[model samples]
Target: MKNIVPVKWLLARLYEPDIVIVDCRFQLGNSNSGREAYEESHIPGAVYLDLEKDLSSPIGEHGGRHPLPDIAELAARLSQVGISNESRVVAYDDQGGAMASRLWWLLKYLGHEAVYVLEEGFGAWKKAGLITTADQKVLIPGRFLATVKHNMLAEVDDVRESLGKAGVTLVDSREAPRYRGEAEPIDRVAGHIPGARNFFWAEGRRPDGTWKSADEHRERFAGLEQDDEIIVYCGSGVTATPNVLALEEAGFTRVRLYAGSWSDWISYEGNGVAVGDEKNQ
Candidate 1:
């Protein structure tokens, strides 16, 4: 499956044994937050994946706060959650595809093409008048054949090249403050790339946290040239995914994620760092 699926499509597959639903609601500053919403209600039969507990590895100074987990370990984790190569996985969260896209990308990384994200996520599912369930089930383990998708990731070297390449658009998906060097909540240095534009990933979603329509997304990103290659980044790589996912939905053909992002960029020894509107300077 592609990166996104309509809620109606996923609803039809809800009861099929070949499908697995995952709830990925997360509140960035509040560690104990998401589960309450999940416990309060979720898509029927969905298993919850916690950002702090399940989706990421522990933080270290040298590592981004949300380092992508080891494939072997992540494979094992998926297996424990009853995900198999044959299973079609659908991940969703309250926010656009922020946390959900992480799992969507992870599934692709694991070579599972049957995986997809709920286009507008759980928020839209509920608004469609679907019934919610408080019944979260424990999954039975199943083996998965893990295969990593290497090209989906943008390395530090890729960003370096993008600085000099006129055809590439390095997009910073962090909030305007962070992108403008007005704030530095997660990383030590407070700055953006030498020539990166601000996309403000959250703009793709509504106040309720569901993703907007593809047309709306296309309009928001209308400032960019269609032929330019896009590389998206946030605090780490986690938050930027919704922007990448949004671009995908908007009909942009070539978009990639900077897996290490600013966390990896500024911290590297001898790497150049810049603050404030670096988009043209």
Candidate 2:
């Protein structure tokens, strides 16, 4: 299956027993908003996955705002939601896959590659005149074994060591204002990692909210060599997953996610931060 599936394609296979649809809509400020939205009306048979509750562990001072959940716990949750190793998982959110991609990346990190993000999210689904249901479906639990892929994730120390290293590229997937240190609505630090380059995650999407073609992504990321060790990060590591998908779609195989991202970086007192533009580097 493709990394991104459209609403029409998904609608055709809605009743497939092997398919599990996940509603990932979330608001960073209001933690309960996503669940409320899900309760109101979501795609038929779509289970809700809360970003703070299901996808991540409680935040400590060191692990950033959204640390990954324990592998065992995540696996159990997947099983409870009727997802098995062979399940074709489709995740979507109101935001342009920012929250949904976190689940997508988490599934991949757990060695489950049969996952795809819904193109254009829930709004697109509604716009396409697809059916939305408020009735919750009771699912019989399935066994899902989790195997963590360490290579897919980059810890804080790993990102620290990669700074200014030859053949390594640290990408700040936040918007330009945050990367430039002009504004920081979240996190304690107002700047970014010392040597990281900015690549706004929204750039990967078109005005209609669908992802750019693979060829377009290749052109956008042309500066980096295919073999470069690329690490992507954003505020709390949620939004950055879209860039991870974009990079993979562009045919770069050596991509890793800085799971803690900027929030974790600033937690260390000694880690240096850079302000202004890349020209200042």
Candidate 3:
């Protein structure tokens, strides 16, 4: 399954019965803002999925700020929104591609291989003078059974086990400053996991908010080999999915996501933290 699709590609398949367009726009602090934006104007026939409500479970002591949602519950929600196992999901958001990628990752984790993120976000879609709507479209629910893929996830213990390992490479998807311990905005602690390399997730996108090509994505991770096992994470595991998607786009097959991420790492008392630059490739 391709990780991304252009706005026009979605535009052409806009009315397809098997296609389900998702609006994933979200703000970290302002939780209601995403759905508010969707209610105001959205791509026609699109259903809204909130990052906090739909994509994540309640934040626990050890599972990071945005823990992965319950598979059964999420599948039910998808069913309610008319997303079945065969639905060709195209998720879009205004927050770069983070929120949309979160959905893409979740759907893939559930063994729904037909998921994709919009290459250009909602902002770009409106800019192109494409169709938009405020009216909510109703449809009958579809059966969405989730077959969870355990291998695609990396728990904090898995991350700890991979530290300094020869074949496995841990990639911190946060920005350089946060990885360097210069700032601690969201999480309780700064810095990153020990022995993890920095690969800022935003680097996957261009200045205009469009995703880079596969060759460009390959160039971004030129330091990494295609066969190496890559584990990616960010603040609370939300932004990291884009890097995971990019890794797949670049043809890196052995990639997994540390879903708890940095926030969950710091939650444990004995977890080691590292500062300053490590190998950045």
**lDDT by residue for model 1 (81-130), tens:** 88898999999997778899888877876678887888778878888999
Residue 8's C-alpha lDDT in candidate 2?
87
| Number of clashes found in candidate 3 | 0
TM, every model: 0.87, 0.98, 0.98
- Taking all chains together, the TM-score of candidate 1 against the true structure is 0.87
Score each candidate by Cα lDDT: 0.83, 0.92, 0.91
Q: Compared with the true structure, what per-residue lDDT tens digits does model 2 show for residues 105-165?
A: 9999999999999999999989988789899889889889988899999998898889889
When 1 and 2 are scored with TM-score, the better candidate is 2
Q: After superposition, how far is residue 251 of candidate 2 from its true place, in Å?
A: 0.5
Considering lDDT, which of the candidate structures 1 and 3 is the better prediction for this target?
A: 3
Candidate 1 runs further than 4 Å off: 206-210, 213-216, 223-227, 278-281
Query: Which pairs clash in the backbone of model 2?
Result: none
Q: Give the distance in Å from residue 124's predicted Cα in candidate 1 to where it truly belongs.
A: 3.3
Candidate 3, superposed: residue stretches over 4 Å from native = none
